[model samples]
Target chain A: MTIKDIVYIALFVALTAALGLMPPIAFAGGALPPITAQSLGVMLAGSVLGAKRGGYALLLFVALVAMGFPLLSGGRGGFGVLLGTSGGFILAWPICAAVIGHLVHKNANANIWVTGGMIAFGGILVMYTLGIPWMAVVGKLGLDKSLAIMVAYIPGDLVKVVLATVIARGLRRAYPNI
Target chain B: MLDLYTPGTSMLHRMSPGPKMAALAIAATALFLQESLLVTALAVVAILALYRVANIPMKTALAQIRPLMWIFVIFFAVQWYFSGLTLAAYVVLRLAALILLASLVTLTTRASDMIDSMTRALRLFKPIGVNPDKVSLAISLALRFIPVLGRIATEVREAQKTRGLERSIIAVAMPLAIRAIKMADDVSDAIESRGYRS
Candidate 1:
């Protein structure tokens, strides 16, 4: 990879963590992982950077988290956090970004709304695919129970899908070369 | 806190990146495998001693562990209710020891050195078409920019507050993303100017 690739990856890793700094909206009384904005970073990375760099960017962010930076939402990190309830969401970020990026790339010539739908498919559907089950296994709940907890975040995720689709479309329009 | 890599001459600062990383992995595995209070306390003490041998400041060490304390509280409270205080202590100690081990390694190792070592290890995957150098570079850059983006977020949030948009995730996300992409473009130009191509 060239320096440009490295920079793009770094920027998004930082973007993901930066998004985490904003306080999360608690879905309930904190039983489920609070809705954090880093998922927006995942969406933007995919919708903008496409599959390779987009996925690498989030994987890079996960590397830092693994390195013990408190970069996660709520400033949590380290190996221990890997065993926590939110670990599934954190680990799934790269895959989610990659899936989103892959689908968005397939529809690159399509209008923004179609690209937006792809983002939701990858970001929401694909993420929950791995995340909800991992939450069940790691958190030691029934799959049914985990799905029940995960249900709380659907509305917030839709909001992210809309926001990311808009920003991504606008970003590309203004800076076509990117 | 895994902040910027501070240059230092402490033993930790002097240690080789590879062994330190191995130690972190081993320590973490050991912590999880064993569940006794004796093992947990011993492990914690051993890590604290390693910190001293590495000459990390008490403040830096505590800062690394501080944010995690809240989660521990919840873990402790919940575990205490279910399994009694002894088991809870064992669990929390095991958890704390793992965090400290990760932080200690991170603090001691230089970012470039760690990346170089990782790149060397990742070379094993080259036959499968994975570019280790590129992966390591990405990880290095990500670590470098965590603080930069953080400052940008704070600045944007302040600006949003002025416009009464602070409460809006869209307001924060839109500008933050636009600015990040702009920064990425400028960086790409910088790289291109330096004769690097994707």
Candidate 2:
């Protein structure tokens, strides 16, 4: 790979890591409630890097965590986190990244609102699909309780979606190449 | 802020995005399916080898992962105290392996290639009346903003620090929300001006 590509990749990785530093806001759920602003990085990764690179960015973060970095929300990482209640969402990241990337890439130059909404929807669903089941299994709670816990995050996630969509649109405008 | 691709001429880098993605899928599946520590160890080794192949400096890679040391400790402690060491080890190794595999894929691949591959993959949904273009747009926006938001967050933090805001919720959340809202509006205008549809 060229030096230029390396620089861009580093930039993306750093960006993803930086997003993790955002303070996590926990709702009134006992052990685990969804963290806010976490998905912003995921959304940005898809929008800016397109599909492949965006996925790569997320993959990089996952890799770092695997390598034992506390880059995830709540300073959680390592294999244990994956096997725990959050494993499902952790596993879903790349899938979500790929899906979001594909959706955004299809309309390379669509307006921000439409693109943002599509991404927000896809990202949230992917997280929920993966997170709910894992929560059920790990927490040993019934599907109903797991679903209820997952539900608490929807409002917050929606906010993230809107924020992600807007920021993505803004970036496109400011840096057309992105 | 998810821009962490490192360019290299490793075999992993030369692999196609489609296969790389498939490999990740396979690896993750295997990770979840098998609960053996031996399997997890092998996976971790394989991941480390990929990092070597990618020529990612060990120091750099470690530095990237260093922050997670506490996480490992906490996880190990919690699992060992509450569950058992075996389970804790299993969890750590499995997650580490998966993360490594993913990072290797990202290090070797390009963002553009990923986007192209995704756009192609989503064609199957067309029969269901899903517009692949719309889907792709959303993906792109999400990917692009990860880093942007990260940068904005940093700026916000620094600004808060300057004001001696002690990193409280109000100090961080208020500005972050305001800035995010303003950013959203700017993005909407940008999209409209660029001929993007609502």
Chain A TM-scores for all candidates read 0.93, 0.87
Candidate 2 stretches greater than 4 Å from native: A1-19, A23-85, A89-178, B60-65, B82-84, B143-186
- DockQ of candidate 1 is 0.46
Give lDDT tens digits, candidate 1, residues B79-176: 68766889778877776787777777777666567667767877898999878766765665676677777777778999999999998867876787
What lDDT would each prediction earn against the true structure?
Answer: 0.76, 0.64
User: Which 10 consecutive residues of model 2 chain B have the lowest summed lDDT?
Assistant: B63-72
Model 2 DockQ (Cα-based) = 0.07
Instruction: Give the distance in Å from residue A137's predicted Cα in candidate 1 to where it truly belongs.
Output: 5.3
lDDT (Cα, tens digit) per residue for candidate 1, span A1-178: 6677678888888778877887888766876556788798899998888898899888878876765566787676654566455577778889989998898877778887898889999888888888888766543344876687678888889999999898888777777756
Candidate 1 deviant stretches above 4 angstroms = A1-6, A23-35, A68-70, A73-80, A83-85, A108-121, A128-156, B1-11, B56-61, B77-90, B130-172
